[model samples]
Target chain A: MPDTLSEATRSEFDRDTSVRLREPGVHDADLSPGWAIGHALNGGYLLAVLGRALGKTLPHPDPFTVTAHYLSATAAGPAVVRSETARAGRTLSTGTASLFQTGADGEEAERIRVLATYGDLGALGDDVRTSAKPPIMPPREQCFSAQDYPAGPDATPEISKRLDLRLDPATCGWAVGAPSGRGEMRGWLGLADGRDADPLSLLMAVDALPPTAFELGLSGWVPTVELTVHVRARPAPGPLRVCVTTANLAGGFLEEDVQIWDSADRLVTQSRQLARAKLD
Target chain B: MPDTLSEATRSEFDRDTSVRLREPGVHDADLSPGWAIGHALNGGYLLAVLGRALGKTLPHPDPFTVTAHYLSATAAGPAVVRSETARAGRTLSTGTASLFQTGADGEEAERIRVLATYGDLGALGDDVRTSAKPPIMPPREQCFSAQDYPAGPDATPEISKRLDLRLDPATCGWAVGAPSGRGEMRGWLGLADGRDADPLSLLMAVDALPPTAFELGLSGWVPTVELTVHVRARPAPGPLRVCVTTANLAGGFLEEDVQIWDSADRLVTQSRQLARAKLD
Candidate 1:
């Protein structure tokens, strides 16, 4: 019994973000190094974990579109995922995956719920192509490390260590108490561990940037009510350039749009999320 | 037995768009009067039906955020809905609902899959409020009926009858064989059935507008890959003022953002979707 228990713990700790199917429709995942904003795990990290689980259950290999609703803040630890196939078609497959934290009584408490679509982008051939100019920014060598800025009042220091973000100085006005008078933020994003940018990493990049609402003179925790991401193309091997913008802020709600361009200058991922402003 | 079967058929034909739950986690719905584009049922109408089913399964009555991925074009017929509760929190509940068409062999073929979040929007309390000006548009009386324009090569007449749309003439350049040079469409929208605008109606309204890509001189069917709608508030009882805009159209893909305002001039729903441009 002791040997079996030790083996299970070692396996859980080894693959923190990877999905391992424990049985059909059930998965075991570990959230290590624990990306958190205060005590709550980062929403994107939880999404990536769930995405991996959904991808495994579907026939396709790429998650072309994914949407998540954060039911509650989750703590970092061993989590369980249960996925069910909603539809399986010739070109696309859709499903839902739920993440849970087990209690001492063996009860599972839900954290985040996601709906995702998996497809083969290559199968959906691109028949029409036009160039939408990417956002302009200084070269990577000229940008400043985003780590220099202090964490948000609700953020933890581990965020900087988990994701390496370098900001365009001109758009970093919010860091110095001066906003650009526009809700926008541009930066270069990559994993701090120097891993290649994949679909999961791009998901994290979509929410990793500083909230665009911060530039509108708003502060504190801006919780995302819902987030939707569209993966256009597989990213090339390099840092991704990201631009986040919010055009409307009203009714205590704001919508943030993010565009991620790969090193090859190809638009890889596009995401938009609606969130509530935590203002006193 | 004959009378029972006849009564079921009458009930199914009478309320095609209304949601009627047959049991916990299961629902019986019809697709009569079939909201169709040529032969396929409209995606938004399907979403509304699925959203209604999910709302019934959750503790909350309002579905504030809903997303749908159209797996395959569906036909008008009897359908079954299976909903699973993913998370039932104190303030919000997230779940998945799958719609299927029952075949002659009693096989259920999945048609549409949805992820939805239900909450007590009124209970959330309006603590923060700021106004964002609604889109600029000519009065409803001044705008022309979109029906006068010929349906797109890919559009069907059912769209015209499903929603009464009045377009701002200046933005309808495509209707007269001229490109607007900008990716935008502004108009007023309301149900053809004259039903009051509720949260479910607003979900349909988000996708009711003409494809913004048409204004950019792109023609044919621009199919939505995925759509995400965020319900900010319960809309007032009147035609909704709407604006749909796309800033980037590249590589056969475009993202459209929509803002919906009610009769009281308050922003009620915001939506964003990614779609493929079927240019000839």
Candidate 2:
């Protein structure tokens, strides 16, 4: 038998260079929506970090999918994140996090829950089919940055570092530019600056497609009302394909379905979102 | 000045045929599988009654689209169903229901929630583009009935249902011939029961199309995993057209997307479902 080390003798920090640890925070500017008030961290921002944290927990480190449902919001104030492992099945793992924001009077203000699942690379098979194919879009190299757009000029430092994207004429590929051995695309993803890949980071990569799919003349911002993603398996170390299709848009809402396939033409995950599309 | 009726003089329940009520223990069946434990009411039955309830609550009763989700089973015990108006906005109206069955412990065993919304019709335009074309199945008039394939030796109620279908050789019009209009079918459908021309009832008529889409072998039990329907607008009180595409089946599940179009090629509603396909 190999020699065993005592608890105090072993270092708590990870020694391997390939492994990473993440830190999440709530900034001051995250508030001001005024719907639930006094809190600085918005649901959208927390949602972004949740996706990043989930992606970081995957075995082979491939970003597959993330989805969140707004159950009920805590009142409005300062908050902390609480995560619990729900189930650790053989092939699938699920993690749940509840955002507990604290109020000025030292009471719980608002609460939000997130459920995310991770899996290994072996879950997909050879058969892959989709009714709607990804339409051609601007080249990844030529696509404009979110800062170039008039909506959120301040999105650069946060959004730009979050995803390293590669766009063909049709699909956008974003992740840390790594080779996912499964023949699928892979890259560095989630909040850049080495933050945990959480729900918001997943949405940032997922939402990047719709805006770029149009010709240069369409001017509008389609904010999502709800986004639901189902991942069949987790990613390995490479490029993941994200394909999006618009189901139907009527009145003030439009539904879009995005399918994220691995390099080997295997289905990894899929997402469906309904957005409120309006002229900016 | 307008006169208002006193509470003592005003009526609560409708004496006329303004609403249709379905009492508990109406359509109980023990043959339901594990996923659907309680009695499996006809999909059309629920659609018809729910539509009528909406018509009575709205201002003009001009709703055209109604969608249902999570088409699963309730508990195996006491059964109860109640529907009430949640909120009514200018362009949209919302309603909800609590459906469940009682348990052996004298309490509500399982409960399901149904949320529906209604919207006014959109302006008709000629650009009618739909995913559905005419089906390849047989036409309606020349289909065969139960007499064509007598259950012969295997004469269970389930066998009789399989034998009693009227199928068109071309479009494969498979239907369980019930005079109540609550049966499965393939091929083209015309309103033979002559029910009121309302959005809800029309949607019910469209939802039952899956089981009949194929011969489905000898099993009388076709289980729906989940169903979602969206109607753009209500059609005139006339015949409608529907085309279905059984896209794919995997992991013990099959999915079909149906497009309901009015005679002149206007999209009426889109319906789809994931179901457990059985050959027993």
Candidate 3:
């Protein structure tokens, strides 16, 4: 691992996404309240908890790609992840997981369904070289920090308090109810607790910022229906630059596309998620 | 149902994506040669096959979104789809499937893994409206049809025979060794069997075009590693406009983004896929 794998990265992230084996294919996890927006937990954090179960059950060590479907919003608490391997190839292993939680109706509800593939990413491919250009943004110091956002009563969304997320001030109009109508968001993201982000934590980073559609006048936390994440190269621990943009928002449905550039300025991750949000 | 659901749509599509229920969660499907490209079945067509199994095993009527990870390429032959429903509620249903085929080593191999959600699309949203702009292209009459491409020894790709896929002539340089290096493809798509395209067929349509990276001078078929399709609305029966583009290609990997516009000029389907291809 890179020297940047600080003690904080290991302990804090493990605390956030760690899972304990219950049976051969089942694991138990505690969804931390520190990762919730309002009452619902972040979708990417949920996927990481599920990823932990899959990463342990499968033969591979790193996740190559993962797709998660949010069946229903889940609250933070004890959850069970039922994971099973679908394929165990020489270099790649595939698995499916479902996180179940007890609902208000006293029913065991499966909150999220995830399909992921794992592999030894180091041996997967060559060095990074991309024709894509990095997202343009002001210096981190000049950007509007989510931490400093004026919180009226809600206590700065518990989730934001856990991350060092700085949004481009030009794109921060939505926070003030003056949306720019541009379906995009650019930010610098890292763990506020000094935990460096690894490939697994980058899963959470993809969704760390406010929804890009929020800039288009959509309010509240737009629920993600389905999200697909592709991890190309693991980042050398540090803050990751992120760009989230959307082109289609029709009939209260839209898709958000994300790109995460590592400290070396190479594209390291990409994701597209379908979500539900209403216009202002 | 729309009058566009002609007998051809029902019969031809059923023949192509049909799955015979073997049990509650298992289905047997015949891999159709008509849907193969140089013996490798088209990724979108394969996704349609998996969607067929999940659509039947689950309670819902329409597939809202599906993400498929292509583990290994399978040739045309007998295959089994082992599908299991993870969640089945009133409004939505989720399921996972593995399409297994006999490999050259005489062992059954899981060719692909698919995760999908189903719901009643008709009741899902409102009328058509979009902020996305349709892809620019010349009139259909001036474009180059995949069927008319010059065949060298091998018959025109078997899969192209199955659809009326037209490519914008300006972007066709990749076909004759003079690539445009733009990494984009614009075209019109429709079923050659005269079958109308519904929301289900849009799954296949998303991956129906030649890999857009071809314009960037990448040769041969770019194998898709993972593909996610979001179906926003049921498309009307007609030739659909499609735009396929990629901005990031590094470490021998790239992500393709596609948008499909319906007859009414409304965005109907969107997809993002990670594929592997080598530059010439």
Candidate 4:
């Protein structure tokens, strides 16, 4: 595992998301299996990849908003990230990226497509006005660690192990014999590799939990068909707070809205994702 | 006005969104001043324009989800929508489109870029599960029509005149001398043209209202920096109920989350948009 990289090497995230310029608006990156659910890559991790590529392609330094559409299931391997800058201004730069993996027949398949706007989080200003309350979660010590219920390699998603995720006992009843039908999940999320959470890392933190529908007596790897992320503020170098709530599941389509509050007690990101599900 | 087009002419929406294929993956459509805020086109109308183009380029018929990033302020005139298919499956197809308008430099400048997933709405089975409550509002007749507070061209947007939108009296206080300071806007939206509301038109309906922050006692047209639309169901042929709420206004950036319910009392669209609001 890349977790034990020497101090001379980059952090697990910086290393995994690092990309090389192949040409203008194109880069080469490897889809690290460690950041995936089985052979399927994590949607947030994919966004992080595109974010990194976009961060490089555009003049802005931080990814302010990202909307990704998972066109097809991805395999863990080498992939090409193609980026394009649509608009570059002083405060905000908008761009798009597509991740492509070549198949055995020599055909390049696009796995994920993204549209993002980048800006300096430092310039986002301190004018915060919010009417919504943050999720109420116990200290990280009180909540049970997701590692408590470790499924085998075939079951437990690798992405979960790469992050220190603790779930609210009230919402994790589904993990045990009893299931809660609330369709909500709250937790404290931190990189298991000890990588400090940033706007880019927050991308991985948003989708780093089991589907909220699991509490509704549904069990399976819920794949995200599409995800939209709004990065409001920069994280304050520590484990962040996370809450995932699913309000609707119609026609086997479920929408999960997530909120991430950094350790400083600031809401850094708000995301809503649409995923397909099978009612049992 | 084209509102009274003869029976042979297409409806205002159908005519405005109709696109002509210029070549493979390219389309030509004129931006109508009627579907705009002053000179800037409405964000949702821009999405519908791209939706119409995507609807033609992709194999599927209906757009299930659309995410648009407004790169620059778009001017009403002749523009081209360029689309590319990323994937086409049996159930869903994904594609991207860019609306480009030629500037005085004779350069084709990209204005709005979109990523959308299309599917057959007819195949979306009737399995709806939602814990969220639809907005409660009085009957349309009981509510005050937006036309009641109409302003001159420089004051009221042209879009308001083209749509028979009715506002909840409780929230429209900002339009008058009194400001509500609740950061919420509830209204019933329908085309003045009486073009029956469908899935495509619902795109325009999602963003047809003034910024919810107007109730916060702010003025000026709020420009949407980014928008994401989730189409879960088809319309039931009537004025759609719309409720927009702004939770946080941080650094002059306000997040407006919207819910649109059709006449059948089903949630047809859920959208979240990030717009820049300069506080007075």
Highest DockQ, which number?
4
lDDT of 3 by residue, B22-47 (tens): 77888888888988888689999989
Q: Which parts of model 2 are misplaced by more than 4 Å?
A: A1-161, A164-208, A211-218, A223-237, A247-253, A269-280, B1-39, B47-79, B82-90, B93-96, B122-186, B211-222, B246-248, B276-280
**Docking quality class, candidate 1:** acceptable
User: Of the true contacts between chains A and B, what fraction does model 2 have?
Assistant: 0.00
Clash count for candidate 2 is: 43
Q: What share of the true interface contacts does each candidate keep?
A: 0.42, 0.00, 0.61, 0.89
**Stretches of candidate 1 exceeding 4 Å from the true structure:** A1-16, A122-133, A138-142, A150-156, A170-174, A177-182, A248-252, B1-16, B124-133, B150-156, B177-182, B216-218, B248-253
Top-down lDDT ranking = 4, 3, 1, 2
Tens-digit lDDT string for candidate 1 (B152-261):
43454576676778988888888888868788888999876676688877777777767888888887788776888888788889899988888667657788888898
Q: What digit string (tens of lDDT, one per residue) describes model 3 on residues A1-280?
A: 3323244546666687888787898988888998988888999888888887888889998888899999877888899999988888897788888899988798899889898888887875674436689888998998888656766525677888778888888889988879898888999988887777777887888888889877887786698888888888878777889999888787677888899998888788898888878655
* Clashes (N, CA, C under 3 Å) per candidate: 0, 43, 0, 1
Between candidates 1 and 3, the one scoring higher on DockQ is 3
lDDT of each: 0.77, 0.41, 0.83, 0.85
lDDT of 3 at A193: 79
TM-score of chain A, every prediction, order shown = 0.88, 0.50, 0.93, 0.94
lDDT (Cα, tens digit) per residue for candidate 4, span A137-231? 78889897755774533566778778888888888888775778887999988888888899898877788888898997788778888999999
**By descending TM-score, how would the candidates be arranged?**
4, 3, 1, 2
Q: Which number leads on TM-score?
A: 4
Which segments of model 4 are wrong by more than 4 Å?
A1-9, A150-155, B1-9, B150-155
TM-score of chain B of each: 0.88, 0.61, 0.92, 0.94
Question: Scoring model 4 with DockQ, what do you get?
Answer: 0.83
Query: Which of 2 and 3 is the better model by lDDT?
Result: 3
